[model samples]
Target: MFALLCQLASAFVGAVIPVFYSYKTIKKPSQKSLSYWSKYWTVFGSFLAVDAVLSTLFINYFIPFYEFGKLIFLIWAVCPQTAGAQFVFDKMLAPFIHRHERKMDLYVERMLDSVFTNGPTLALMVN
Candidate 1:
């Protein structure tokens, strides 16, 4: 039961990270930064390769405990799960991000402004 729960959590987290990254980085349809194939495969391939090597070296051989279950977990973690991740990102997370993007940008701008123009610079005011 504990192992199953851990596997599920790992799988879900593995799915979410790429989706969140893509949602945060890529622009909308008109101003898209990466083509569909490029974005999908870039995230998928990178995760897959990393997961493969790590699973092979550590999960499969070095540690040599729960090897079968860990490989199964890795499969669920990597695989073609990106499509589902992207769907979740698009349908859920993307809307929330779009809604708050302006406010977030403004907050960042003000934070940077204070850092660069205020504080000790108060003494340097040249007007």
Candidate 2:
């Protein structure tokens, strides 16, 4: 279960590639329409998708092979499959994350501006 949790968390992190990229590519005014985010997003998503399908098929498609099938898959597919996830995150996910974080900073700034301007005004009126 721990390993499974790790896998899921890692996969989710990998999936964040496009979303972060989407945020990053949009956050910066000068970096508009960059393919870096989209291309890597698609690649990681593809790797994850294909790995899942293959793993499922490997497990169910050959019932006769049973656990033996899984063992073979463990060696041939599992490591690479998960490794691909890590690669996607390390290679593609981190870059976009910075951009997303920039967007978050903007959101926080807007929210703070609103709060600072309105909160004190409301407090004074109430007093």
Candidate 3:
């Protein structure tokens, strides 16, 4: 039960909390900052989408797996350690991101291009 809650919280924190950090890091809302925010949201949203699908499948198919002590491992993702999410992103995920940097960039570019090119319906929802 506790671990289930932890899994839920982990997904929320991983996806939503980064926006706050991005805001804090950017002192001004210049073109660069705005673009940075857009990219940040894009990447985070993509990650969250993938995570939701995977977690749903796992929870549905592997109920017994979550019943054991293995669930404690999720704490690394859920708990905000002293260094915080940025540290984990930089130290853990960044390398993998860099390895696939071109693909990520292409995906973000195509996604943003499509969104901005279309009518402003989705834009309003994002705002």
Candidate 4:
């Protein structure tokens, strides 16, 4: 149960990071006109969240098939899932952006910290 909570939280934060970055640095989206922002993230989150649930079910429910099906699952499940996740990670990472344009240093720092925390914690949880 706790593991499930962690996975969902990490996935949610990971999904939204890029949205925040793009809004903050690249386009400077007006917070008032965030309809597209809300929709984009909703779509992104729903896609990843659904796949995550499906993948978990498929893995646990079909152990024998999971091993043989890893390749198919990688293509059908993991790649898209990870792409959305990475999109969330990559939005603000470019040259010549200023400090004020950064939105807040603490948020970026926490996001980076999440990567470190999630990686090792995920490895430990899985093993």
- Local accuracy of candidate 1 as per-residue lDDT tens digits, 1-127: 6556755655555556546655755644333434443444444555567668886676644553454455454444344444543553456546865899999899999998898778667767754
lDDT of each: 0.56, 0.56, 0.57, 0.50
lDDT of 3 by residue, 11-87 (tens): 55654565575666576567754654455454455556665786678863566545232224333333445433344
Against the true structure, what is each candidate's TM-score? Answer: 0.33, 0.37, 0.44, 0.27
* TM-score: the better of candidates 1 and 3: 3
**In terms of TM-score, which candidate is strongest?**
3
User: lDDT-based ranking, best first?
Assistant: 3, 1, 2, 4
Q: How close to the true structure is residue 73 of candidate 4, measured as C-alpha lDDT?
A: 29
Greater-TM-score candidate between 2 and 3? 3
State in Å the error of residue 72, model 4.
15
User: What would the C-alpha RMSD of candidate 3 be, to one decimal place?
Assistant: 7.7
Give the residue spans of candidate 4 off by over 4 A.
Answer: 1-17, 25-27, 31-33, 59-127
In terms of lDDT, model 4 sits at 0.50
Tens digits of lDDT, candidate 4, 1-127:
5445545554445445544655574476675335434534544555556667877777535564433343342233223345532343245322213435466577899888998979888899899
**Going through the candidates in order, what is the number of backbone clashes in each?**
0, 0, 0, 0
Clash count for candidate 2 is: 0
Question: What is the lDDT for 60 in model 3?
Answer: 34
